[model samples]
Target: MPTPASLVSPRLPAQAAIAVPTSRIHALRTGARAAGLIAAGLGMLGLLGGWLHWPPLATLGAGSVPMEPNSALMSLLCGVSLIFALRSPQSARRSTCPLAFAALAVAALTLSQWASGVDFGLDGLLVQGGASPPPLTALAFIALSLGLIAMCKRGRIHTQLSEAAALAAASAALVGLLGLIFSVQSLGGETRSPPSAVALPSMLAVLALAAGMMSARPDGPVVSVLASSQPGAQFGRRLLGWLLCAPLLAALLQAGVQRGWVGGSSALALGVFIALAALAAAIVSSARRLNAAALHCELELGQLRQAAVVFRSSNEAIVITDAQANILTANRAYEDITGYPVDELAGQNPRLMKSGRHDTEFYRMIWRELHERGAWRGEVWNRRKNGEVYAVWQSISAIRDDDGSVTNYVSLLADITSIKEAEARLQHLAHHDPLTDMPNRLLFANTLERSLAHAKRHQHRLALLLVDLDRFKRVNDTLGHPAGDRLLQVMAERLHSKLRSGDTLARLGGDEFSVLVADAGSREEIAALAGKLVANAAQPVWLEGRSVDTSISVGIAIFPDDA
Candidate 1:
């Protein structure tokens, strides 16, 4: 049977599998870039408002605290850093470090000035009358800088660290945003006097920075899990959206009551009811979908178990490998044919059984076919544990994931050593004489035709000599056919030894033999070779306790000279 191109698990229905769309990934990256741009634009507006005396641009509205000049500058630095962090790792690190460090330094210095009760010149450095950013805003900027730094580094731990920092910054910024929305008077009370609260624009900028950081590093564990197309992520996203929007909905109702559009108690009661109803509805919808998905997964798992059984019990040697071609598992038949146990073969590269018969280019073609067409089938010679070379008809298939990335390779190998041996034996018998173990008449004629063509093309000479054992009929009549057979074999070996390595010696039939001398050089060389053949044939050989002598008569025909 032909090996399956994709294994059972990969063949599952699209709905039953986790399909991470390439378009979605691209959207996430684009969103990250947009978020960075938005943060930078907001920062630039704040800087302009501070300089141009525009309250709306800096504070986002009348009676709101303005985003400090230092805060706006930090935001600008972080925005640039976040954008740079989205690039290739090497370039990201090189470009993002300076911006991230500058942001970190400014935020640290501002926080240090606040804690020590000192006026840091950094606050009013950009604007003459500007106050330092609120303590909460400075802390958020610090977290944002650290996150950008972590995002530029490689490894899962660094990714998780960056994600954690982004979440921390987002949470801090969200608190500031909530304070502004609810008009909370006590949110930033850090001194005898009311401390300057986190500005509306500053909070928004930090939120944008946090969002951009998370979106830029989609491979991070937290982002990957949240953005995944699995059932759990989808369900979690639904509940999360509801939770965020439900509070805002409740807050709007509270604002209406404060404005006297509704009774306070009635608004509170209605808000509770609405929140609970939405929660219950979301739960019901998610539960039904998840239950259906669970059933589908169960069916798929059962099918995979059956496939596993077939894989283990199959007569053909099967090997499963990771994308890197490291062996993951192999069937019993594989162990039997390769003479290696599963324990030893596991985690090993498939090149362990390579035979020297094929060159590097041969394996390159197989890999090329597998990548282009996802499958390849051909004969391969591999060495066994005992150093015996064996041939196998091998079929390899690449197994890909829902993302169209190759995840594993499945190789099915069937031993063809015995078949190859049988073919070789049949081929040899068809082209050779049985008695003297030399080329037969048919093979000799074909060889002569090919040699003549080669000689004609290259302007070379060739000699075709027909040789006969003199008085062979007398030996057959007196000493029996067995002695005559032995005499023919002996004469054939002697005649072959007298010619060059590129010569063909064939036994036509009975005492008749032919020799093809390719590239025969000159007439003198041909005559010398014939004399040597005659001298060697005259030598005696013992057969059945008696010495038998044989002589050969040669008739030469040169190509283009005598034809």
Candidate 2:
């Protein structure tokens, strides 16, 4: 677990919060629901007019003829769907089944009327010739049905579905409105015909449906993404709005120009001016968002640069390796300690530094610990580039991906060669004499105990001699302590030279020494060795450019005989 301070990055407070903003989404959804209700009202009005045979209603419905029962029925179904959309969004989301069935029925009746001049059993019951709905009406219903299907199947509107639904509704409205305008305009021309009967109500209904769908959930994935404080989302949302409005605006502008209500040149200039204004708004918004993103990236880059600085300047060696234990890179300290350049180590296995002091089982144990615990730390002996084996204290950690698979390994090591050497020197000094560099009494006693046990087990005799230097204090008092020390070293060397390879010689203190002669055949042999040691010590008299006389008194003990 990380501390709270560690969880937060000091450099990036702006990016710390990830919660979505909902104010814009709520406003958009409310507007869409309101539009859907307005569309439903218009549809109902059209339905009532066509059923009551009122001329005003008929004009809005079937353009001077009463709407056929089939047309009225389809309008009623669309009105119901819009009402469902407004009242119960969740139920409306899953209401595609009924809407699809109704759309298919409307499509079938319209096709029958278009192809065979058949009325689908309503020939005599409603107004005759103008009963069939226009092709755009069928298309509108199909688009709505598809939109509903998309919404229901996905359970929630995603990006692609929202785009498709918005495009379908926008296209339906554009086609119907454009067709109605053209029909009205053509009335003033030589060729005069009534507008398609389905135009007004169907256009209004689909527009309402599109608005409702867009506002169904203010914080839905589509709206949330589009309204986010991100450059790409802002640009895309603006672009989509421009595309939806551009065709209708252009068509209206062209109609005004053709009707002489506006000059063509003036209209073209106005269109261009409006387009540039929209483009400027989009650019400014995108620029502001992108500037924020750039600043965020710069802060992150600074942090990375700081981390790089620390990595390069650290005293300890650091190595990074791939999953297979091949070295990828090493820091400057690694190069200094290992005596290998970064380039030389690259693409080479870490085993190239193995000292061969540890057996294969040792390496196997290291790998096992790493796999189980994701890290291993201990003292390891590795060979330097100059072929010298040196000790290092190393820690290796596994770096893993989000899925918990190992991706890389980071090893941190420090050379402990000097420390190990110091520890060995301290241990030797603890059990040896400082002046003569000989085993002290503590070590000699341990050796004597072991020797005595061995002799008793093998049924052999061992002899011990304790020698005390005579007249050594007089030389130290007259010639100085340095001369006395040199004399002691010389004496120790002489005694050591006289002993057999298997014998032990140790300095007990200032001028007293002890020797252990193991496997001495008899007391006669021990007595002869003691006399020889005594004579050798008595002859050593050279010190400080003068002949200093030094003599020793020897005391001998036979281990089993004394016992």
Candidate 3:
């Protein structure tokens, strides 16, 4: 049987099932490892060159001096953490706690130096004259502290860690790169000036730490999200355009500074315009993605609402059940037809509707067919909540899962009680006289045949009487057929009252009837019944504001004697 399309369960949208791709995850891990190694190497080289006073590396130092011991120590801590993350992710995650503590200590020391101009004793051992910390050292420690705080969450790498690390690394790298480029430009035609002490190494260390933290865990939010096909991931990838544009913009600014073509106000305006444009692009992209997702959700919701409408408003009673036949849900028509409230019926078995009209075997057959073919359709007798037994045309089908295991069953029922009653009435009308409401001639013949066989088997006397109304046509012709019909109805009632319970009194035609007198003793007894029937017919019938007389002519036939 064909089931309604709306009856099936809804499925998840394809986009909703998307997950991060493996290839992208691999790329993230590789990038993080490479960045971490580069930062570790740069940190170690800068530390060693400064300590040993190596010429080639000393030229790259700030004011021709090596990095401060404390600043190099912080860089070494970040580099070591990144290296550990690259080697063992779980260990790296756990190592974030100590890293965060160390970063906080570094930030505190740097802040003290910035605020009080105090060397804190370490700068005196590392460099002569007890030089003060570079301006960028304070900012680098602040960025490191924030990145470590994000990374140290409950001793695990999380989405917050990745985002914070990325922002910290990007900001630190941009500041250092910009400052170094400006310093190099100033050296073009004049004496060379020293670069910031912490800028070069801090930038490399921050980038390594950020990349390492992002790829430290496969299940980390940033790596998983970036690897996925979600619109947000696509938008995030698009934001990488800023990373590419930053260097070009920095180069242009550096050139302008060198040529004295751009003032501070012009440069500030250029920066503001670029920032606003990027922000607008990001907002527009995010809005478009959100709109598409919202539209898809609305369409799915609309379909669900339409299906609910059809289920609630259907004329046929609908019931949904689990595989075990426990009622899960029912519609309004189910309540109307069964006279049971939905709340009362839920969780109950459908056997509550049993009317005792069908046996256990009948239900067994129904289930057998349902299991074999997944559907069964036929008429069933069920009881209403008011104790009224009624018939229904019911159809049942199984709802299966992808594995072909039955998950639920749906039943549709239409009340067929009126139709059944009408069918019985039609059968009766075909075999009985309409006017007198008695078995007609065709039915009388069949009764006579059965009576004859019974009498012959028992050696008893049987008699058949055909009673016809005399002057019946004259009465119809004068008083009308309605009066005639009324007279015939009265005669039938009178004759039926006089006959024995076992005897047959059938109206065979307009003015004729057949009576079967079984177990008669002799002809005299049969004649007496015939005379009585004639007397009953001769009585007056009151109809149509007048009394009309009707007479019947009786003819008798004996079973053996007539034969």
Candidate 4:
């Protein structure tokens, strides 16, 4: 059986498949070590940079500039975090060393940034401005963004940490936004410190955006992992993760600016973070909705399959045709009735079932009526697969498309052979007498009427002879009705045999009958035919091993003049 197409996503490239597992382990390990280094750097940066102190081994003995040591710590923080991230991709969280390390490193960096006192604007961006520090901070965040995107996309690690990635994105945005706001605003009279404090939070936001994009792959393993998260309900849990980080980062940025970080505005960075977090939350919510929808669609698919099976197995003969009157499908009953396999019949002309009993005009009339009335329910003769013909009661209708175009045709048919036989029997009952099996008074009257009308128009004589048996009732009384009926049947046969084939003889009832001979020569010929009816009908009929005699009294009537 063919596998359902929807069940699987297309395979990733070979490089993508192999590189993910290999690189991610190292990346995670590096992330751990890097986080530790960055965290320590953050603590030092917190104590020394915020105070603008040039440690004793400081280059050129720091004053307001706070050279070398401050720059060294900031650079180290960025570098260590990058290493942790770079090595962490080992397909995704292969070893907790990398994941836990990176998380702790970032957390340590966050706390250091928090501890640094938000009033730091000492790098000349605030009271005394610098030439390249602000531009450098922006450039660094941009580069980090690009690096994470390249790694996540190429490694295809989004599948490994779906929930975490989404939560991470939201958290990053909040931190970035809050940090930017707090860093840009100056509040209580406080000693502002250094440029790197404000810049750190912005770097984290760029990382968060990369992680968000990575986790969006439809079949990525990240989703399976996300499904395993706790401490949050299905919808709100993800949003909650993000909200927790924003306020802390915001307060830190505010404190950092008071202590003198870069004088540049932090507001823009904070706004970017908020936007990113909202977007990430939206993405996760949409994914859950889609999964629910897919489940519903799967249930509907099963019902449709069951319905198809039912349609195929129905016992009533059903034929479905294209608009052009070609077979499209047929059911088991159709095959049973026509002795044709549905597979063999599909794409063949449906007209193959038409027997030649009807002429062209007859079929045209049927089509005309059907098209006009939207349906035709009547009897027809159709051929079986073996060239045998059968009578069927068929109903055909047009199947229309939404645009009112006739797209198909459907027919339901059943065998009516027995019904036809019953109809023939009814007709025999109407025209002939039951006891004698001869044309009855009703048939003789019809024949007389037609013959008289034709004779008048053609200037010819027509005659009718009334027949009565002399003693049919007495025979019935003596020999029983069975013998009497036999005598009547014999008399009817004799009268029929004695007449010319064109003449008609009928027993009206009991002893009564009528003979009709049309286009007669004259009264003499009419008299002769009537006399023969009397003589021949006198023959005895055999019944139960005995002979019963029957005689007739005939009254003759000639058309035009009763002579």
Q: For residues 350-452, what per-residue lDDT tens digits would candidate 4 score against the true structure?
A: 7788899888987788778767876777888989989988888889888664345565677888988778889989999999898878888788788877887
Candidate 4 minimal-lDDT segment of 10 residues: 1-10
Name the candidate that leads on lDDT: 1
Please identify which of the two predictions, 1 or 2, would achieve the higher TM-score against the true structure: 1
What would the TM-score be for candidate 1 when compared with the true structure? Answer: 0.90
lDDT of 3 by residue, 311-419 (tens): 8888889998878898777888889999998889877999999999999999999999999999999999999999999999999999986457787899999999999
* lDDT computed for candidate 1: 0.83
Which residue ranges in model 2 land beyond 4 Å of their true spot? Answer: 1-303, 453-461
Clashes of each: 0, 1, 0, 58
Each prediction's Cα lDDT score? 0.83, 0.71, 0.71, 0.56
lDDT of 2 by residue, 1-563 (tens): 11112212212234232223455655665676566566556656655665565646645634533444455555456545644654454776656447646755665656556567555654334443335556556666566655554544434344347446655766766766666654543111222245434446556667676666656544445555666656777787897788667766787887798789999899889889988899899889988988998899899778867766777788988888777887777788899999998878877998999999999999999999989999999999999999998999999999875446686788999999999999989999989999999999999999999999999999889999999999889999998999999999999998998899999999999899999998986888888888888888888477778887677899988878898
Q: Which candidate is the best by TM-score?
A: 1
Q: How many residue pairs clash in model 4? A: 58
The segments of candidate 4 whose C-alpha lies over 4 angstroms from its true place after superposition are: 1-303, 369-374, 385-389
Clashing pairs in 1: none
Worst 10 residues of 2 by lDDT: 1-10
